[model samples]
Target chain A: QQQVKQSPQSLIVQKGGIPIINCAYENTAFDYFPWYQQFPGKGPALLIAIRPDVSEKKEGRFTISFNKSAKQFSLHIMDSQPGDSATYFCAARSGTGNQFYFGTGTSLTVIP
Target chain B: NAGVTQTPKFRILKIGQSMTLQCTQDMNHNYMYWYRQDPGMGLKLIYYSVGAGITDKGEVPNGYNVSRSTTEDFPLRLELAAPSQTSVYFCASSYGNSYEQYFGPGTRLTVT
Candidate 1:
């Protein structure tokens, strides 16, 4: 079973537009959610992360909105630029274990 | 701090070949993980180590073995490589309390 499912396998948006990617998980024990951005030929880097205790978090142009009751979460990029084009992955991990489950990944493109 | 680093930026091996991917972290993080990324697919966990002597298999660990003999080094070994093992491998490290994971540049491996 896929523990975390992400939507919109790919997306394209004009500069300054908001693009959103979403994910959902089935495991209730998951307490931490994180988003990663990866450029071609490069490894993924952490963009932002949120704990289930918070409803939302923002860092620069990246924001993560989480819904614990719905077992869902979404990532929003505000005022996106071409530099924001990359693959995005949403991941969840249980607080008790060191293992993390990752989504398939969303390829995002921002055109100027 | 060099955060995390991986060796052999790229490699190509024939079927039944064996190789080892090396990973090291300058940061004294308590948790380390190895992942493989394929095109259109997200990152798949291969193995993880919580400490120098504690290691466990993740979602996809077949044909792969790992050893964490020191806090700074974690190496992944492929016993008998196959075409199905062709993918980019990444190493990540994080603190026990911190949810953020730092990733290495990645090693692209192709098994022919």
Candidate 2:
């Protein structure tokens, strides 16, 4: 079963526009939510993460908005750039904080 | 520091063949992980180790084996290659269970 479900398998946006990717989970035991970004032929790198204790977290142009009651989280890239084009993954950590469940992936493209 | 490094950037295996994917980290992390990423599918954990001499299976550990002999090395072994096993393998490490993970570029393997 898919523990984390992500929407909009692919996305296209203009430069400077905000591109958002959403993900939802059913397991309340998950406490840590992280976003990873992967460029072609490269490994997925940690983008930003949010714990259930907080409703939002931001780093640079990336922001993660989380809703604990809904068990949903989203990534918003402000001023999206072509260089930001890549595959994004949202993941949730098990209660033990050792194992993680990842969403399928979202390919985002920023057209200049 | 070379956070994480994986050997054999690309490889092709024939049915019934066997091979080992090498991984090394210079971060001296206590936690290491092996994951497989298929097209559009997010990363799936194959195996992980909390520390040297301690290892455990993850979501999809079948058809794969792993060992963490040193804090720097975590190798993944595949016996009897199958088409379904074709995917990009990634190695990651973190200081602790709650710390952010650093991922290697990845190893693209094709099993025919």
Candidate 3:
């Protein structure tokens, strides 16, 4: 079962614009949602994360908007830059489980 | 702090060959995971370990084995290389499995 689903397999945005990537999960037990950024030939790294308790969380130029009732969440990149061009993955983990579910991924390209 | 490190950044193997991908973390995390990523696909977990000597399978665990002999070392073994196994492998560690998962660079494997 695809526990987590992500939209927009690829995206393109202009520099200084905001680009958003969304994801949804089916498992209700999941409480932790995290976003990862990956560059070519590199492993994905944690970008930002949020729990089900909060509606939104922002760090620097990145923000995560989450809705517990809808089982959906999104990652927004503010003032997108060329350096932000890469693949982004959304993942969810249950509070008590050792497993984590990951979304397919979204490739973002920021135009200079 | 050399959060996580993987050896043999890239490798090419022939069918039926066997090799082990080594992963080590300096963070002394208790949770470790091995995941594989295919083109345009989200990462699939192969194996995971909660602590030394405790291992479990993940979503796609076929033809792969793992051992957590120590908190710092988690090695993934491939008994017989196959074309289907050609993908990028990543190692990740988490302190207590909450939100953050630190990842190693990655190992690119090609089987012919």
Candidate 4:
């Protein structure tokens, strides 16, 4: 069973457009949600994160919108650029455990 | 600080072959994890360690083994290679159970 599920295996957007990637989880125990970005042949890097206590968190052009009750979270990239083209993964960590569950990932392509 | 480092960016193995994937972190993190990413399937946790000498299995642990003898090093071993194990492997480390994780450049392994 996949603990975390993500939609849209791939996405394409033009420069300056907004790209949204969504994820859902069934475990209510998950309290921390994070998004990672990976380029070809490189490791995934932390892009942004959010705590379920807050409805949303934003850093620069990246923002995370979290709904605790809905058990869902989404990442939105504002003014998306060609450089933002990469694979994005959403992960959740339980408050009571050390293991993290990751989503299948969404490959976003920004066209110039 | 080099964050995290993984050895042998790529490898190829024949059926029944064995190999060890090395992971090291200079951040002195106590939590470490190993994950495998397959095409369009996302990333799955294979094994994780909370601290030295304390290891646990994650979502996918079959055919894979891990050991953490020190705060900075975690190694994953494959006793026998199989086609199903052909995927990109990643190592990650964090300060605590729910803290931000740092990931290493993945190791791409192929089995014939």
The DockQ values of the predictions, listed in order, are: 0.75, 0.76, 0.74, 0.77
Alpha carbon lDDT at B26, candidate 1: 95
Q: Write the per-residue lDDT of candidate 4 for residues B26-48, one digit (tens) a residue.
A: 99889999999998888898999
Give the DockQ-based CAPRI class for model 1: medium
lDDT per residue as tens, model 2, A1-108: 789999889999999999999999999999899999999999988999999889999999999999999989999999999999999999998898678889999999
Model 1 reproduces what portion of true contacts? 0.76
What C-alpha lDDT, on a 0 to 100 scale, does residue B104 get in candidate 4? 96
Per residue, candidate 4 scores C-alpha lDDT tens digits across A27-81 of: 8888789899999998888898888899999999999998888888999999999
Using TM-score as the yardstick, the better of models 1 and 2 is 2
Which docking class does model 3 fall in? medium
**Candidate chain B TM-scores, in order:** 0.98, 0.97, 0.98, 0.98
Per model, how much of the real contact set is kept?
Answer: 0.76, 0.67, 0.65, 0.73
Model 4 regions lying over 4 Å from their true place: none
The TM-score leader among the candidates is 2
lDDT per residue (tens digit) for residues A1-112 in model 3: 7789998899999999999999998888897899999998778999998988999999999999999899899999999999999999999986675888889999999999
lDDT of 2 by residue, B52-88 (tens): 9999999999999998889999999999999999999
| Alpha-carbon TM-score of each model against the true structure | 0.97, 0.98, 0.97, 0.97
Question: What residue runs in model 2 are displaced by over 4 Å at the alpha carbon?
Answer: none
For each candidate, the alpha-carbon lDDT, in order, equals 0.92, 0.93, 0.92, 0.92
